[model samples]
Target chain A: MHEEPLVRWDWIGRNWPNIQVLLEDHVVMSLVPIVVGLLVALPLGLACVRWRWLYQPTVGVMNVVYSLPSLAVFIVLIPVTGLATRTTVMIPLTFYAMAVLIPAVVDGLTAVPDHVRQSAVAMGFTPLRRLLRVELPIAVPVVLAGLRVAAVSSISLVSVGALVGRGGLGYLFIDGWQRQFYTPIIVGIVLVVLLAAVADMLLVLAQRLLTPWSRARGSA
Target chain B: MVAGEGVGVNWLIDFFGDPANWSGPDGIPVRLLEHLQFSALSLLLAVLIALPLGLWIGHTGKGALFAVLSANAARALPTLGLLVLIVLLMGVGTDIPVLIPLVALAVPPILVNTYEGIRGVDPELRDAAYGMGLRGGQVLGRVLVPVALPLILLGLRIAAIQVVSTATVAAYVGLGGLGRFIIDGLATKDFPRTIGGAVLVALLALAVQLGFTFIQRLVVSPGVSERQAVR
Candidate 1:
């Protein structure tokens, strides 16, 4: 049982194209939902701040949605959306992202100090200008933190798409299990973890670049 | 009037209505028991390992980095991938693979929570405990643990819900758990069973979450609980 090497170089040598395709598919599947989710969550999060009462009830509902098992969400969607299309995975994952990211966005925006908002107003900034320039810039660290989480989770979930034969790296898992192939299973894990790590690292780097003040504040 | 419809409500009703579906080797109750068994055992093992390590680190004010790193790493792991990898490594035919991944999934929350909870204990309390002639162990037990109970319980709740939900993956590895319905149903084009399984798993997760919340309210000290609520 221990004799077999964990990764098979020969298989990779023969099948680099297939591996590349799976990797690309995985990245694409993971990223598309994050992008879409951000677009939705930003506006919704802003609205939450605008209407205070909407915050608690909406978060409560989203929490329930978030707690629903990811697989169940995928399966239950088949009735409404049908199967095997990219939308099947995209819809549920986008919701999951919003569930996490909305609160993050809200918290991030709310965390922006009142003095910062006052200074922006004192400088004659309009509501739109204030949100875009002052509030958002300051909230970048927290929002990006939320984005990092959403991205990592979405990447992990893309594999669950394999249940419907639509998973990216997930395909490798289901197929490897059926064929009893150790190489693909190990490869898939390495690639997924590496992808998650790389994605997280890039987000962290983005946070640093976008909010140099945060780094300064932290060090002080 | 049409008596039936395609793969929707009627199928779900019929799936649940069948008495055979509730009492057999592969019945709902048995699968639920299997799912709960995996979750409960994994949780027990995780708490045993994480609680003490977390408490020690928290008490000594060390290993904060380890706590954060472990929690982040655990979250990034794809539960399905981990389950399959362990099964492949262990060479199947038993429940070890499933249990291993479930425990792995459960540990970080409890570990991080316990560490953070213990660390969050007010320094004054620790000094007071010492001033009153308490030893290290007594200070931890009498003062720290009570104060840390809320966060520790929060961690347990997170781990328990997670294990309960993800335990369904066990069905994929030819072991019988609640996931069997979804995997087997999909394989055989049995959409009703698939939907039923999904619903059951979701309900179980929600129930566990609610149960933990209730337990948290009942057990956490009122003073500490109020502080938590204010936060």
Candidate 2:
């Protein structure tokens, strides 16, 4: 007679610390890229909108970035960045977020009523002051929405970083699947889902802070 | 952004060379062509199966909860898990990944748009249709679907771009597509070729978005632009 074991409660319990380590690594990797992507894409989107002609090409880039699967991007980056750290994991993620951010920001800017822009100039506001007080305030909602997409997209993307050997919750999913360990996989999925929800909520809070008017419109 | 660097350059050469020995049973471009076939087949199957089913499910309003559950599950479920499960059923290679993710990829937007559109249908129209002696099917077809058509196409907009982007992941199982170029680049530590592949995939996505936007205008119920007046 032979006995087989399926549940690895004991092993999983022992591995909690290791999983947390992976989670920390994953967070650092994912966030750095997102912040950097924002620093780059926001300005690009703003300038592109003002210039007008750049809109087609700039947005054209985002659409392309949006389409490519994260895994494909990871594979492409790995050859140069190699198997470890942010270079391999974060670079493509930032690129992916740009697609979401650029369009949203542009859309937000466009969403501003044309009359508002006209009135600001009529009031004799300087161009810099006009954008700072008028154009940008109106555009905040759109920018936040784009940033929301970036948040969600980045959360999903961090999972792919697992494939590149940069740890996060995706580490749990990938390693568990590699060994056919369901418990860890389940844990990883739960954590990733929670992480996504939490990130989304934080973005919601940020949105509320940035746009007081949205609070009245938003039911939640 | 290290746009140009020694490691990146060296990796690019290695990647291009890696596939140098990757000839097929036939001739040159055989491997590349096979990959493209797999990608195209998957995309077509997804559109065929998912689009109609989504349209139906969207109309039914009965199966929405199930559709949402399935879509979310599909979004989060690892492709690796499906790959392994399929392997247990039938030895693994290309076909299933192509088929499985297509349905998974297409379902969310199709279902979302379908439900959102139908549910969002003006109550007045439904009342009018009801008074006209229209049965349920006729009401749905004539009024609901027409009204919902733009949003549904918007969902298609999301789906079209997504499906094209994800189809490349088919390379994990050795299924062919531009992903092969990326994978080949990675295995040999080649950056330029990898970048080249990423560039191509991104370009394809952009091309798909532009093409689909045009299609949306043509196929969407005429005066879709006018509907923005509602928003």
Q: What CAPRI grade goes to candidate 2? A: acceptable
Kindly report which residue stretches of model 2 are placed more than 4 angstroms away from their true locations once superposed. A1-7, A114-137, A216-220, B1-22, B25-98, B114-154, B157-167, B173-231
**Top TM-score model:** 1
Q: Encode model 1's per-residue lDDT on B34-110: one tens digit a residue.
A: 88887889899999999998999898878889988999888888878888888888888988877888888899999
Interface Cα RMSD of candidate 1: 3.3
| Docking outcome class, model 1 | medium
- Give the Cα error of residue B143 in candidate 2, in Å: 7.0
Off by over 4 Å in 1: A217-220, B1-7, B128-133
* DockQ computed for model 1 against the true two-chain complex using alpha carbons: 0.51
RMSD of every candidate to native, in Å, equals 2.7, 4.9
> Per-residue lDDT for A36-149 in model 1, tens only?
999999999999999988888888787778778878878877876677767878888899899888998889999999998999999999999999989989888888988998
